[model samples]
Target: MEKYSTNAINADAPVMLATERLLLRQWQRRDLGPFADMNADPEVMRHFPAPLDTQQSNDLAARLCQLIARDGWGFWAVETRSHAEFIGFVGLRETKPDMPFGSCIEIGWRLAQAHWGKGYATEAARRALSFGFEVLALEEIVSFTALPNLRSQAVMQKLGMHRAPDDFDHPAVPQGHALRRHCLYRLARGAWQEQQP
Candidate 1:
């Protein structure tokens, strides 16, 4: 594994991991503007209910930072190694208890629309999965998305995660919300190890 860096806001915060082309690092002030812009973009937020306003975007970023500070890991702020630009986030986060796959760690990613189709999500997520299995010693990591989010599901498949039989409605979303219905995917630690050389 490549050595990870910790050029975070402070010593308390640390860069979580690195991939060949990306760094999964602690959130920085420089990330806020692009993050808010990405959250506000309609096309980027299309799979969700609606785009986030500036405050909501800031709140979400704050929460992600807090989670990482508390647990030493969460959805990490991702940057391109070449330009050191903050594109978005990709890492592991604790799944909400109300969800069908209760109390599990999940791997997820969201990048600016301009950064899509470059295989960044898959590359970063593979690093996150390694952290989960190798460092955290987790048995499995799960991922889920609204049924229509085939693009995200494709990433899960590429990472060797298999869909589970049960699909559930996301409790946080309204009961009848079009995006409430979600598909679950899981990757066992053994399965992840098998994929390695």
Candidate 2:
């Protein structure tokens, strides 16, 4: 396994990964407001159970920052290079214990509703996958979403991840909730390397 420096990630520093149009960097104080707004938007949170309030959003951002600081990589705060606008986050995170895929890395993204339909999510995710396979030396990365969230599933397909036979109920969601059932997707490092030029 590849190891990253345990030194706390500095949010103010420039990111190590940069796509042509985006920069996946550490979280900054400025990101909280926009992240909170994004989390509170019903349209944006439609796949999840409910929209987050300001406090809940801030707490989530704080937890993400803490994870990055501890692990030296995580769901990085993503921004457009041209405008430096905080669109959302897209990167790799360790799957929570409650998830069926234990002790595995997963790629995920959440962007402001206004930023949807642009190629931003796909572009940023491609870069994140490279970091996972090349930099982190992970054997595989997985992604899952509420079965109804075809938009995210489309992005997963664009990244060349295949649908896995195992569909799981998200433990974080209520058992009978409509969003509890999630479609799982997986991409092996060899498969990812094959797609690269």
Candidate 2 lDDT by residue in tens digits, 30-133: 99999999999999999999999999999999988888776778899999999999999999888877788776889999999999999999999999898887
Per-residue lDDT of model 1, residues 8-112, tens digit only? 324365546888999998898889999999999998999998999999999999999988887678899999999999999999887777887678888999999
lDDT of residue 140 for candidate 2? 91
lDDT of 2 at 94: 81
lDDT of every predicted structure (CA atoms): 0.88, 0.89
Error of 1 at 78 (Å): 0.4
List the candidate 2 regions with Cα displacement exceeding 4 Å: 1-15
Each model's TM-score, in the order given? 0.93, 0.92
Looking at model 1, the pairs that clash are none
